[model samples]
Target: MCATHKAFFSYVWRKFLNMYRFSVISSFLALSCFLSLASYELPDHSNGEPTTDYSINEYWLSLFSGFSKDVDVFYVYPTSWYKLDPAEPDFCAIDHPTMLSRSKVVFDIQATAFETVGNLYAPYYRQADAAYTLSLPADKRWAVVDSIPAKDVIAAFDYYIKHYNKGKPYILVGHSQGAQVLMLLLKNYMPEHTGTYARMVCAYVIGYPVTAEFMSSNKHLKFAESAEDTGVIVSYNTQSPSVAPGANIVLGDEIGLVINPINWKRDETPATAEESLGSYMPIDAQGNPALIPHFADARINMAKGVIECSSVNETDMFNLSGKMGPEVYHSFDIPFYYYNLRENAQVRVNRFLAK
Candidate 1:
């Protein structure tokens, strides 16, 4: 090789090696930080473990004040066994949950898959010009009320019913543990308050199951299968039929209720309505830009290729390039599945209101 070319190749080789080293280090720091955050010690609620009551209450209050449309939406977030009580004045003082073993972590990995997918439905409760709020309850606290099935969520909803919701239409959204609780509420609590059902604009219960038994036993339970803009159920799960993760599995029974995260309709193909998000006018399944919800749709432009590339085997997906710090990464990467779902949801919710 010529001397100049050899020097250039040497430099490129060195750069690649440095980049590789940086990737390894960054991933470690990022994972460590997430562990630190996820493992924070929770407070001792009256029953023992921490409670998500505070987060749920705050979210409801925020959503109530944030929107001017005069509608009510009940939102819930699932709990992780590793959840720490954010309400505790001194969250760092308590020790981490050492009782949780590696297997528990794997279980949580699968459980949180649903949690992450479920909570993404929050922005769907409002119109293009309005705002929606989300409140999440902490999970896995020792307090009887702090666990996923704890009383905080129900109590919060009851509080809203007693104080705010009278005749206005509403939406119900939840994920994982929250979805489980919401399913129960729909089956038990909402029925007693039949008026609540009449007002339900829609319910997006992701990452939780509404079993065939539940559907069969209760004539009232049904999944939304249209884009007509009415009250409906939207749910779905992510999987390649051949590459199943084997444990903490979400089976056919559980997966049956999941709707396509793309278009809200049950029968439509799970392809993006607009192939290139960064365009002037985007169209839906009908190929009409007039029907698109712009604000929510902006995400498609920003995250067009994230989901398929989410599983970066290295510690960090983005290189530090010599920057010294922990680099954290969230799931639902580029072409964020959640953002597309959020946009699709807004479009559907708006249609429901227009009618």
Candidate 2:
């Protein structure tokens, strides 16, 4: 899995750095450990207000500041079913209550994977897990949380709309399990909030799918069909034609929803595309990078179109299975994924804000 993620990284490094220096540096054990340091500290969000409790670590916020625009992006990360001991300093412990925080006016919900005890990473379970977190706070802790109820998700969104959302235009972003939650958010909330959707620049959902059902339901919610600017949905997923043994297999949401970041289209072929990094590269009509965004291309299809995890979509069968888990290979993959998704985000969001 690490190697697979690294391949995606190679593509990204090729696109931006001009040389694979980062990859070379990344190979060094000590340097890699230092890079692994949390890019951002979870903001201190002990407060109870929905908007106030959401905060981005300084490192993350610093990175976000590089954006050409001031559009606010709310990020929801996956969580494990670990308990938070307010007694502990890592207030951002894996639990319900500890997940809530007051960092910005935006609302950031943390997906709770901490409490559920099972061989997770299954298809339907991921959907259910993501749905559960979409409505919870960054710090709200729960005991023995239920893991199979989609209805809970609907109710949670209702509560969020009444409380947190209250009618504000916002950008949505997520990865992996969190991405699953974002998918449901678009289907259940975004479309219905067309007024808000219009106000929303776009959704940056990576490592997940934006299925046909979702695309067909909302005329406004289209995938990034081209490298050119787009609105509403900017989605993609990474897949390796063959992952190493013992890799983590993520199942949920069909492959249709899982798109190739490079093309922003359905996953169909392993096109041999090359990325160049140099002084003069083509820029999009919108002034964004015209070259393929780094790390945007993936080897697997994440947005397969299956509503139920157990459904008959062959894409659902695809997994990162093997001896080691996804964690081993995620570092390389995550940056590239973020690089591509953010590049598209920069374009679509600027356009959305301009409108």
Candidate 3:
């Protein structure tokens, strides 16, 4: 071959190799960018410090102005934190933006049930992830799950009592993990502080189990006998009639007292769907506030310690992801009996006042 032809071919080969190398480098950089965008990380707290503020104005969801009611609803919200860096922290930080946003939606759907009957006071505490209780065996999970979150709840309650409660009668309301924290609060706080127990209207601990052992041990706390019963607990776990009880949410053999919010009865009486006044759905078709009315019938199954509902309008609000079956209606516990609970709160409040 000619020398000129050999030189030209060599130049072409080198250019081709350079272009291929450039393409490979560009593709590698693009893939890295995509992975970074896809990866999930817990929101970074300022200076990596968890918030410690529990002042009524800062944490309370509803701080009524120029209005007073005979009863105050001290509510604890359910599992709103989904992300955790198993290495970084077990309990979610209170001021984390994601936790704050999620807790607001919970307050609207669950806490609003008591708005008409009393002044609502919901505190934002460090709540364990939904899987916190389910990830480990019953014995191990309860201790770890309650450790950090329980302290914040106790502190918040103390703050509420000293500043906001002002000798007013109060109702303890909690759902799912919130209920678990409140159970600890009731057992530890109320028994020692008899004044707080005397002013208590009732405790509505929904979604989580309140075992017979716990109640029997805590003599000051009484389970509700009827709708108008004062200073008692109104608790129940809801599921479809087909779903059996024995889920992790209700630990142990001794299932505690359950009152049917629909019928306001302790027995296995079926309350028709017509009896449910309304359920406050946080979002509408367009993602707006929509308070929907009467979509479920409830009947207590004394054998299982859960309320069996006939129907549920399964929306994003009711959608919960867990090991629990369809029968484990944890999300719909409050909404299913929204109005019934509101009216029952008034009944108990009035009865407490009368006495």
The number of the candidate with the highest TM-score is 3
Residues 214-273, candidate 2, lDDT per residue (tens digit)?
Answer: 578666567765555545565553434343332323332134454444445544543223
Ranking by lDDT: 3, 1, 2
Q: Identify the candidate with maximal lDDT.
A: 3
Q: Per the 3 Å backbone cut-off, how many clashing residue pairs does candidate 1 have?
A: 15
Measured against the true structure, the TM-scores of the candidates, in listed sequence, are: 0.50, 0.46, 0.79
lDDT of 3 by residue, 210-279 (tens): 8787788888788888888888888998777776556524433436568888888889978887777866
Q: Which ten residues in a row have the lowest lDDT in candidate 3?
A: 21-30
Candidate 1 minimal-lDDT segment of 10 residues: 125-134
- How many clashing residue pairs, candidate 3? 0
